[model samples]
Target: MNKKFYFKSYKTKVTINGETITVSRKGFFNLVLLRLRTQVINLNNIQNVKLKEATNFKRGYLKFVVTKGLKHRNVTVIFNVFENEIAVEMKNYIQTINNK
Candidate 1:
């Protein structure tokens, strides 16, 4: 995996696809503490969640931010696929610590 982006702490929670992905001081810190490194490629502008080469997990992790029947910021939870599920392979590219 390649390092490409960084996440900043938000004061409030953001909703994505009906699911409230919290980014609070406590919860968000935990996700970062795990040191997950993966780029969140926002494909909302394309108006489609399915990509041309989405099924190809062997290449890399791919997530689509769906916002069809929602009312907040769209998001996609992506992770490296292994065997038959999304694999949590991060830490190599990103470092987690106190956001201060």
Candidate 2:
């Protein structure tokens, strides 16, 4: 099954399937200025995952530490209070995959 979550405030979307996780940014500004292209990460390539719970004053973020070369690059998706649960779920799902 394919599960998708969208965070409107951050203009980011995360899609989880059995084998891969896909992340894409929405809006023209994010596409052009940020140069944030869609990232398709395989389950095997994820080194670690982190989820920061959202507070009233600050937005939380789900970060994926992807294995690239000698250094790791973080792919983060920001989420507000309303999206906290979904972000946690995504983190849990990735952890489960890594354990297997």
lDDT of 2 at 32: 85
For model 1, the superposed segments whose C-alpha errors exceed 4 Å read 1-30, 33-47, 51-59, 68-72, 81-100
- Residue 57 lDDT (model 1): 40
lDDT (0 to 1) per candidate: 0.28, 0.85
lDDT of 2: 0.85
For candidate 2, what's the RMSD? 1.8
lDDT of 2 at 15: 89
After superposition, the stretches of candidate 2 with alpha carbons farther than 4 Å from their true spots are none
Q: What would the TM-scores of all predictions be?
A: 0.22, 0.84
Residue 52, model 1: lDDT of 22
* Residue pairs that clash (backbone atoms under 3 angstroms), model 1: 37-90
